[model samples]
Target: MKKQPIHKIHIFGSVGSGKTTMAKNLSKVTGIPCYEIDNAVWIRNPSVDIRRTDQEIERNLQSIVQTNSWIIEGVHTKDWVNQSWQHADIIVFLNTSYFTRTLRIIKRFIKQKLGFEKANYQPTFRLFLNMFKWNKQFEKVDKVRFLQMTEMYEEKLIIINNRQDLNNWINNL
Candidate 1:
């Protein structure tokens, strides 16, 4: 018997938890297209980012999942994302450390501010502060909620707490 190739993947985690990095890496190795959930939620522009209508978001998500292969990454655990999981072959929960995420937030902000990194929205001081708040909220609230919601999908869920674990999982794939 042989293992089947993964076609659809969903990666969820707090801000700066390396969800995007993991998704991009997996997509690179597997030749799957990677998408950011934030992109589905927001209409990106040079001046400002506008929120997409709920229907629009749903339609967009549906279009992506209807494809043969994709890697979707985000921290969003709302009802809108439920359908993605339903179609996913695997769901990855990145349980990165608070300290590490905090550090990455700062580094990412600096890079984005200095034009070394591209961002969908402007990296303002307020947004930088909000990232920390969001990180805390994810740890305190969303993390528990996500765990509860994902209980039904335990068979396909993979929780990676550190780089070694992530590396090992990717290697096995």
Candidate 2:
């Protein structure tokens, strides 16, 4: 079968669910620019992270979606981000395992602390702990909420739980 042309992809998941990785890889292969929703939410500075106004975020996202093709990924699922989903040709929800996300969280923290990984913000212990909290909240609350929100887009939504399945789906794409 001929592959469908994907103009826009929205990928959302918990902190360590590989959303960024998937977006980057997809962008590389498809020649689409990958965007981080976090960048839309915050103006990153070495000393401080400033939050963007809701209007600013909306305008930023509007510009991206107006482009021909893009791959936007992040954990944001609020109303402000609903426009991205509305414009997406595909929506990927990574329902990664709790145990796996936990492992990735620890590994990411260590790598950031060791300067092996580049982080958008200072990787402090508080933020490291928050990753765990966010992950749990995502599993307990956001996961269900996301499912409910995306039900209207069922035909375009894809839920991935493991690396193998993700790889297969990517290969097929």
Candidate 3:
């Protein structure tokens, strides 16, 4: 079967769910520019991290969506990201197991701490601990919220629960 052309893509999931990795892969396959919402949300400072103003974030997001085609990935599912969801031709939601996500988080932190991986923020012990808390919060609270929000875009939403499911979806694409 012929693969459908994707113009705009949005990937959302909990930390360590591989949203960025999937977005990068999709960008490579589709030749669409990929934008990380974290970049828009946080202003990278070498000494300390500062957050962008709401207006700034909105403007940044607007600019990305205005492009001809792009992939946007982030764990954010709040009102700030509603526009991206509305503009997306497809929304990929990674729902891997909590165990898998936890392991990934540990591995990712190690990679970032060792400077083997590029991260939007400095990987510190606080951030490392927060990942676990965020993962739990995501499973307990955000999962239901994300499901409810994505239901309106059911036709465009694709949920992948495991590596095999992800590979199948990408291969079939």
Name the top TM-score candidate.
1
Candidate 3 runs further than 4 Å off: 1-4
Q: State the TM-score for model 2.
A: 0.96
lDDT of 1 by residue, 112-171 (tens): 999999887999999999999999999999999999999999999999999899889988
TM-score for all models, in order of appearance: 0.97, 0.96, 0.94
Candidate RMSDs in Å, in order, are 1.0, 1.1, 1.5
Better of 2 and 3 by lDDT: 2
With candidate 3 superimposed using the best TM-score fit, by how many Å does residue 75's alpha carbon deviate from the native? 0.8
Could you give candidate 2's per-residue lDDT for residues 112-133 as a string of tens digits?
A: 9999999989999999999999
- Candidate 3, residues 1-173, lDDT tens digits: the string is 67677799999999999989988988887799999999989989887789888889988999999888999998877777888988998999999889999999999999998889998788889989999999999999998998898888999999999888998988877
Best by lDDT: 1
**Candidate 1 displacement at residue 62 in angstroms:** 0.5
